[model samples]
Target: MTRAEIFKEMEEMFGLVPSMFKSIPDATLELEWSLFKQVQLAPGEIPAKYRELMGVAISAITKCRYCAFFHTEMAKLNGATPAEIEEAVHYAKSSAGWSAYVNGMQIDFEQFKREITQVCQHVRLARESMGPGDMSE
Candidate 1:
């Protein structure tokens, strides 16, 4: 699609074409907008609410204030409660903290991967052996 076509479509969908998008080169505008619409705006395998909540967590970890605000509002638009958004950020904080600690400590990567694999296998087997009524997600 041409840049004019992409801009028209963006304005139609968003009520305005964001200035960030306008700065994209005309040659790359269509492809860039296509990817943003597909992955960020569309609800696919992951429902929109959960996906936006995940985006919030990632934005927090990456320290992107702009994306953090955008995803938090999108999460609300998609029906995430304030508590859910807070919890997602807390989880991100915990995960990021542990990652920093582990990497800083210079832990053995091979051992960590092996242990995680074993834990997953064990949990899978345990879940499979549980009775239908005893199983929970």
Candidate 2:
């Protein structure tokens, strides 16, 4: 699609095209907007609320103030509670902190993968052993 066509679509979809879309190069505007619509704006396997919360978390981790603000508001509009938003940020922070430690210490990737696989297998087996109506244990 041409930049003009994409701009028209954006205006129709959003009621007003954002300046950020205008800043994208004409050569790449169509492709960039396609990706943005598919991943960010469109509803898919993930619900909109979680997707927006994920955006907020990612923006916070990346330290993008503009994206953080935008996504937080979007998440709230999509029915995310303040507590859920706070938890998402905390979860992002915890993941980043652990990543820093693991990468900084040069932890063994193969060992980590093996241990995670074993834990997953154990959990699967335990779940399978539980009878359909026996969730007590």
Candidate 3:
């Protein structure tokens, strides 16, 4: 769509076009732009590339067309190649298969809960390590 057309849509949706939306205008344009910015700039355990890949993975698994397109675009901007993005999606699918297999093999909700808890703990640790205090003094 034309830039002017996009801005017009953004105005209709957001009441005022956000700066980021100025580049791509659409409905909830401001919210979309803000989310993109947060994903890039937020302090988190995951590196930006990993976050981008994660977004792509979620998009792939959930089949969110808009999110897939937006995240793939962001992934490229963050230095992920198209191939790498594809690889991430492949891995996500593979992981899903692994999860299903494990669930079936054990048939125990407790076991699955423990596994999830461990994974969440790891994520928390990683996020903590990413904080400013963790940086070299």
Q: Which one is best on TM-score?
A: 1
- Residue ranges of candidate 1 with Cα displaced over 4 Å: 132-136
- Tens digits of per-residue lDDT for model 3 on 30-78? 5665575466556589877878989899898888998898789878878
Clashes found in each candidate (C-alpha, N, C closer than 3 A): 0, 0, 0
Better of 2 and 3 by TM-score: 2
lDDT of 2 by residue, 45-100 (tens): 99999999999999989999999999999999999999999999999999999999
lDDT of 1 by residue, 1-137 (tens): 88888889988998999998989998888889989999999769999999999999999999999999999999999999999999999999999999999999999999999999998898888889997767565
Candidate 1: TM-score? 0.87
Candidate 2 residue 64 C-alpha distance from true site, Å? 0.7
Give the alpha-carbon lDDT of every model.
0.93, 0.92, 0.77
Ordered from best to worst TM-score, the candidate numbers read 1, 2, 3
Q: Clash number for model 2?
A: 0
lDDT of 2: 0.92
